[model samples]
Target chain A: MTHLPYIAAAYALAVLVPAAYGLAAMRRLRLARTRLAALDPRPARRETRRETRR
Target chain B: MTAETSAAPGGFEMAPRAAMFRSVDALSSLATPAPPKAPGRSLHRFANPGRFLRLAGALQPWLTAGGLILTAAGLVWGLVVAPADWQQGDAVRIMYVHVPAAWLASAGYLGLAVCSVLSLVWRHPLADLAAAEIGPVGAAFTGICLATGSLWGKPMWGAWWVWDARLTSVLVLFFLYLGHIALIRAFDDPTRGYRAGAILALVGVVNLPIIKFSVDWWNTLHQPATISLTGAPSMYLGMLWPLALTALGYTLVFAALVTARTRAAVMERRIRALLMAAAAREDGAVQVAA
Candidate 1:
């Protein structure tokens, strides 16, 4: 059917957008973790303060 | 006075000076060593970023797994097993993707509005961060909904575009999501930005119900909701099952995404606070040397 391609494209875009967003979020998390590690040499100790506050 | 000169007078003469310095020292110590402000009790257990992070971290994997599995099952079944419409033919398959996205677009905004309320009223630490993270994801879904809806519309309506109420309000919803994301990051002070974004999100909530009831309220070309709270579902079981599966999958995926983003935002803020604290400490050291 003429609309078959449209259906396929619709689903493709639907999956692609959320996948891209999730991956981008993951990348940002990795970058933030790296920065956090660099800023605090003893990351464990710094996080300990957070743990205690909780 | 030089120590030797000061000692030339009776040591008792320095008592008032000593007492004044002691009081000043006490005041400075009290001021400089104030404890971190405690988090609010509104979401009591989850109000703290650290606690929220721990919870989200633990839930992420399960949510991801559930999302992936359900999405896979629904798409496979819907695309392969489900029969095509006799009238619309395979073009009806687009509903599998479009419906879930439309549902999420509206639901995600509902989430954003709730988070905004938690942030503004209860001052929950994670609320603003959650709201900030939710905006982009919600916007992405809304964009998907609009695009897919257009694709579905082109074949069904014979036009790729329309200014119908449902379509227009959903477009406005997409813009609201974009505006919220921009507003949250506009200021140098994140707190100010968050407050501004929170107010905007709360205001934007008025559009949601409009988006929900637009097809009914207006003489629009768009179709009425197939899924309803008051009545039985209009869709057949064959179509309903796949839609339900995909909707649940999409929700799980959205949850995973927002949770991950919120944790990242928490980490970013922690890093910023740490850097500020380190800089202040350095400044104090330099002052002591001077």
Candidate 2:
């Protein structure tokens, strides 16, 4: 029942399929909060220890 | 299967709304398992907001890359390489988008339900993050499924929309997704917000089955099963592969989005903490100067 427009629709869907997913991934990218990237664990613990010793 | 919130059928070919609610009778108190770590101290590692952030950062790009590639390939395959159908002709191609969208609409809620169980039971820090991230994505999928369905419907069903049982139930599912997103953000204390969202997710789960079984129990205008049935697809094989590719693309995209959103949740927490600390430092300096 479909013609060239229908083919175009399928192609559009193909684009949309990933496009939607990519958008979702982008949302997730914003949501990520990585702690390891910012912290030096050795120093943080040592600082806490030094305070206790005093 | 997670007992609290399964990838439930919401008034779909595979599920019925009443069936889900009925299952809830014995399963109401179901909760997910606790962390493998020690109850108090080791568990703290996971709940240690900082550790969560590190993991989130590392995983984000991988998911995005994988998601982007698969989705792009799937679309290319569906549009360019896949052959058209004999029966429904080019119109059959809509299945590529429609089917995947439909699947996510239901699966998204299922995701929420699982996170809610985890949050309520183990009180995992990531559980709320999962829920918080899932809400918007799920809603978007539902919206896509509905929009695509409308386009597909105009060509096939002779109308853009109908008062069919399946459509109504799916609409309800969309609303449920919106409600979940809204409820989670309503509170100032995020823990309380998570708790509130958890309860709503559990309750909203009731709608999943309704949408699944709507086609079967009710006299719906929508078509019946394709897979999990015999020789049921009215469209030819030439068209099926492209649609399958689209489905694969959609799924990968969902995974990618989830990974990215989860990472964002982690960063947001850090940002909030940093702001609070900065404010506190300023307050102390002001007090000392005074």
Candidate 3:
């Protein structure tokens, strides 16, 4: 059996899986940050709750 | 989950029904209710989200560059420079990618297990988030290992897959990753989901040692470990160098991934918290209007 196809399939899947995952993560992160900024513009405000809890 | 808030006029367009309650107007009062900053004397740094975000932002570029360069260099050396095995010919070249991915599948789970323990025992805020983010990456690497192993196997063993101990255990590892992902997102409350997922992760860890020892413990078609700390490696140096390079490259890639994903997870949690606070404020306004 020619090992060429097997080798190609293996490498291709390996690269594709990680690349796909990384891209999806980046997309999700971008959307999340946008929503967060809209909801609470000031990161400092969150620190207030921590202070009261302490 | 997407938090749908309208960007109408000056701010969100309150739902039509929300306008019926005069309390809805109170949302405007919340606009400037700032939280007091922590005192200057505090020494703890990393627990701060702002600090962690800044650190992640700074490190990401360097991590990306290093991971890409190492992976590229290793792939080139493995594909173009490494000699083929006498018995397997070019098929053995798959080892460079295959071995590193397999190692990562195991390593990533171990990391997940550690995060699970930390989350459960110490209630480390970052631990559950890290554990949650790691599931996908671990699953991906596990998938790669299985696919590559199958590919290599077809040529060598004359079959695409078998119920051999190593292969079967790794399959179980893949399912465990899937289970973690599904369980973590299964609940309406994220905290509950995290707790459930952490318990599942702890239980699933028994599979790790089994996956590692499968070849030694059982008579299997899978070969024994090529590299061992106890004695000299059986592989030739020509083959060893590429494997080493790819292993380092893959590890850096995994590190970069974990860092990036963890940062994203933190942001997601922040969004959830902020949304909940906003809802609570709205509820208080409604009560006053009533």
RMSD from true fold, candidate 1: 20.5
Winner by TM-score:
1
The top-ranked prediction according to lDDT is 1
Tens digit of lDDT per residue, candidate 1, span B1-290?
Answer: 23432233233222322322222122122123233463443244455555555556656677778888888788776777777887778888888878878877877887788778777987776778888988998899899899999998898899888999999999999999999999999999989998999999999999988998999998899998776655556666687667666766777777778777887888899898999999999999999999
lDDT computed for candidate 3: 0.72
Each model's lDDT: 0.75, 0.63, 0.72
Local error of candidate 2 at B96, Å?
A: 0.6
Better of 1 and 3 by lDDT: 1
TM-score sort, best first: 1, 3, 2
- Candidate 2 lDDT by residue in tens digits, B174-263: 888888899899998989999999999899887887877777788889976565332344444455545544554565566556656665
Worst 10 residues of 2 chain B by lDDT: B22-31
The C-alpha stretches of model 2 lying farther than 4 A from their native spots are A1-54, B1-45, B49-51, B54-58, B229-237
DockQ values, each candidate: 0.56, 0.26, 0.39
| Clashing residue pairs, backbone N/CA/C < 3 A, model 1 | none
